[model samples]
Target: MKKLVVLLSLTVILSACSAQASTNKDSNKDDKEKVSQSSEKKQTSSDVYVPNPQLTDDRSLLEIGQAFKDDKGVSSLKAIKKVNETYRIGDVELIIHDVKVIEHTPSYSMIDYFHGFTHEETFDFVKANIEIKNTSDQPVYFSPIAILESSTGEHRDWEADIYLEELNGELAANGSKKGNVGFILDHSDKEVEWVKIFTSDLLNEEQKVTNKAQEITIEF
Candidate 1:
């Protein structure tokens, strides 16, 4: 009888150990799934493109007009330079420090419910890091209005998003500011040859496109 009781006790101990091992395996599986879900959420958040509120409400942007009129580019872009090279537009000195092309995988798009703008179309963006300096004695206003010209002669305009902050206001005499602007274009397999960043005086609302307008072209 003592031997039988000892055997039964051992059986119970073995069963308890087996159960604990099974529970541990299930817990590990749950932990792995949780980690995977967390990683997916982080990836999804990074893919979304949000717009800037201050620039979004600006009515002046609508007045800028379409990129191509009569199948011809309206903006008279000046010379094109590679990244890190400086170009001049009137008295303002501008440089495109870097250029990056961003692609949204899984083809995500959005409908801005509040603003009533539909960004549902799948598109890619070419972002340019720019630096603007006022070389003249007078204060000049800098408009973040520009276009991205592809090697194939395609022209994409400056898209107003959170990354393209407000460079619309005035810059003091000899003052400088740095920021990024993005151009919206179709998801292209081709590479961009150059980028054109144009600036106009906000103070002169009547003459939207005039001789005072200046442009800086950045080649890839």
Candidate 2:
């Protein structure tokens, strides 16, 4: 009878030990899941892009230009990754997808045709495929007169734009637009190494024009 009682006690002890082991395994799994979820949240937060408030504040063209200079200017096309990266210039976010240099591009109008036929007034164009995004709370206007500042300090604006209807327009809060813009340059046999792209509110002449415009720069 005593042996039977001892046998029963051992069975009960084993059952209790088994239940505790199962509980520990389940608790360990829950801990691992919680840790994994926390890591994912951190990754998502790090991936989000936010513009610098100091750079995004309403500022003048010259002030924005100075800020650009201070930040060591913008990134060049070669430096940009294939993943659509947003760059903050003043209050504007700019992405230059591609830049193409076309030789002997025809001028914008019949006047160009008349001039070309009469005095050979043809020119070359540097076409750019760009995307601009406004991150500010207020609406911002973009100018088609994006200037190309050469390494030698020569600044030239677009002569003809056929990629988009109007280069100048208003972009609402959190708005984005993509289009092609072209710049006219003197026909040259030499290749351009790099040029900086500048968009300014100072280029606008309307009554609602604000001195709070910014000059955003992108290098290509």
Candidate 3:
């Protein structure tokens, strides 16, 4: 009886060791697969173009517009073009609509900007560089990227503001365009999540492309 009991105990231990080894091997394989996938996401070469949204946790929230109804590309811009609709900054239902992507370079595409350098008291200190590209063989221009809004149930369209008005021009067909715009928020009221971009001439009767925006904050 004592010999039989010893044999049984040894068999049980051997079986457990084998099971543990198999589990470890499977886990290691899964980890390697995940690492390979992560590496693939960063492998875009210089010839393939990508746009930039200069965002930071201190001043911005970023979301890819993948759920747009008409998006066809493998990127956020493709999604925005497909959806042909608008979204709210947060739960407040402040609709920002008619989001269009311009082929211009992000450095030059004018958008609603908060000037922090001149008037320190009335603006935000955070600025973003928006880059847009025209991923095609021929040239094209997405002139005046525009969005619409609704106030009191009334429909309105708006554009980005350029202190230099002559800058409102078209991107060449089949080619890419670039532009630079910025925003500045005072440290006291830094909780801005959503912003509206539009073209307006209402400020000085010049009727140029400009921005009319409102601040929506979590704590507000």
**TM-score rank, highest first?**
1, 2, 3
**Candidate 2 clashes between residue pairs 3 or more apart in a chain or in different chains:** none
- Residue 209 lDDT, candidate 3, scale 0-100: 20
lDDT of 1 by residue, 39-144 (tens): 3211221132233331221111122121212211122112222266566666666665555554322111222321332253333455665666666666544454
Candidate 1 TM-score, true structure as reference: 0.46
**Candidate of highest TM-score:** 1
- Who is ahead in TM-score, 2 or 3? 2
Whole-model Cα lDDT of every candidate shown, in order: 0.42, 0.40, 0.25
Q: Write candidate 3's Cα lDDT for 1-220 as tens digits.
A: 4443343333323323343434444335434434433433122122222333322111111233322211111112211212222222111111221222211111122222323133332222222223233223332112222222222121222122221111122222222222333322223233333334432111111222222322221110
Best by lDDT: 1
Error of 1 at 24 (Å): 60
Cα lDDT over the full model 2: 0.40
Estimate the TM-score for candidate 2: 0.44
CA displacement after TM-score superposition, residue 215 of candidate 2 (Å): 7.3
lDDT of 2 by residue, 1-220 (tens): 4553343333323323333434444335434434444432122112323332211111111221132222312211111112234455445566655554443323233334335223434433455555555556665545533446544344564333433323345544454444556554453444555666555442111223343233334443
